[model samples]
Target: MFSLATWNVNSVRMRLEHLLRWLKLRAPNVVCLQETKATDQEFPYTEINEAGYYVVHAGGKGRNGVAILSDKEPREVTIGFPDVDDQEAKERIIAATIEGVRVLSIYIPNGGSVGSDYFLYKLEFIYRLREYLDSYFDPDQDLLALCGDFNVAPEKIDVYDPELLAGHICFHERERTAIKLLKEWGLVDTYRALHPDEKGAFTWWDYQFGAFKANRGMRLDHIWVSRKLAQKLKKAIIDREPRGWKKPSDHAPVIAYFEL
Candidate 1:
């Protein structure tokens, strides 16, 4: 049984304790973290080492960072899109091979509003991710898992109130379509594939207005597995305990188990 988890920590420096505690409790073999918001110089390498995981990270000083942690040392670590010099996306993506599996930590941008520049960039980023996969890997043969805070809710069932949130930034049809195209590239949404009809199984909630208490959230975080890895998938879940913890990030951790 190999367990892998993905979470948007919001800020690694601010939520270090929570991460340490969760790591001890859950004991996942590999972890992919997004929104670490710490540059290489400021990353808590020593502390993470003490916690018993080898980590590789990329990011800026204040925003859009991604990291992967494994109990064993990771190899073939890659940062940003391969063969593409995308500065804005530099810190938002990271990948490494751990225990014979290629895992990616991605922090997809949250578009501010419809038809905005950021929104367009968000769409472009998703397409570029597909291209990246096409150029580097074959989903039919590779043992790959892509995990992160995707920022887009792929289906109506993923949100608490579909009618109310319709056309919202994360729940928009365009965003859903983009995610669909990505999935068509030979990836499976692990949780949805397992719990096909589950509703309101969200991973992110607003930090305001008691959204977490009310369970008014969106399933923005995901663990997408390639076809070969998907065949080994035994379980997938959204662990909401961390979100209820004091000083928690708005996003919860998503965990997947495989009979590897």
Candidate 2:
């Protein structure tokens, strides 16, 4: 069984200690990180390299970065949306193939709210991603995994209060449609696929308002696998342990295992 995890660390530099500790505890074969909030020059490559993994990052100066760290050096690493390099500036995505599995770590833009410009951008981003995935790889043939902070809750059961968060940024209808589009494209939500009837399983909690204590959190982060890889699905989990730690990121790690 090989394990892979996705985490939105908020800021890799600020959360390095937590990350290192988590790595020691879990030691997943591959990890996809979002919101590193650092430039390539500023990314802690030395520490990560010394930690016994090769790292690849698409990092910006102050916000929105994604990276992949793996026990094996990846083949064919790409930054941003494929075939759209000129408009690729936000460092929201980094993809690579490790051990024949094509994986993508992505940080979807927070829509802010309904009808906001950021919301539109978020929708566009998802649409383009669907196109890119379809163009670049065959879900039926290629072993693919798309993981990271999606920033969108796929269903009401994914949130603490469906009625309360109905029209919110993360649970809005338009945002969900975009997520559904991905499902239509053949990516399975590993957690939901494994925990169909489960609830109160969340990956993110607001730092304020004692959200974690009340368990008023939402499942914003995810690990999505293509049909080809989902066949080997062994386990999927939302690791909330780190969330209870000191100075933790608002987000927790989402992990999945596959028998290959």
Candidate 3:
């Protein structure tokens, strides 16, 4: 069995202790982290290495960042889209081939507001992701998993209150459509695949207004797998315990297990 987990830690440095504790508790075979909010220079490589995983990361200061941690060294690693020149966007994506499976840690931009330039960029990022897959992988053949904070809830069931949240930043129709197009390109939402009708299963909750206590949250984080890789899926879930811990990140970790 191989276990993979994705988390948007908000700020890695701030939550390093929690991360270390969870690492020991879960012991996932691979971990995909997003929103590390630390530049490569500031990343705590030594601490993470001491926890027993080799990490590959690309990041910027106090903003978007992504990383992949695995027990075994990756055969190959890529920091970003080969053709995309935007450094910030580059910092949001990182890929590594571990144990013959290609894994990607992605932090899709959380468009601040609907119809804003940043929102358009968020949609464009999804489009570029499709292009990236077209150029580098085959859904029918590749064993690949795309994991991290997507920042968009793909379905109504993914959000706490579908009607109330309609057109909201993360639940907007445009964002859902964009994510659908990416899924059409050959990715399966692993958690949804395993729990098609599950409701209120969210990975992110706003820190304000007692959102977590009210169970008002959205499933913005995910583990998407290609058809070939999806066939190996055994279990997928949102680990809410960490989010309940003291001073936790607004986002919880999503974990998936597979029979490899």
Pairs that collide in candidate 3 are none
Please give each candidate's TM-score.
0.98, 0.98, 0.98
Best of the two (2, 3) by TM-score: 3
Tens digit of per-residue lDDT, candidate 3, span 1-260: 99999999989999999999999999999999999998989999999999999989899975899999899997689888887788877789999999889999999999998889999999999999999998989999999999999999999899989999998998899999989999997999999998999999999999999999999999999999999999999999899999999999999999999999
- Per-model root-mean-square deviation over C-alphas: 0.8, 1.0, 0.8
What TM-score does candidate 2 get on C-alpha atoms?
0.98
lDDT of 1 at 230: 97
The reply for model 2, stretches above 4 Å from the true place, is 86-90
lDDT of all the models against the reference?
Answer: 0.94, 0.91, 0.93
Error of 1 at 197 (Å): 0.6
Steric collisions counted per model: 0, 0, 0
**Cα lDDT of model 2 by residue, 150-241, tens digit:** 99999989999999998899999999999999778889899999999899999999999999999999999999988999999999999999
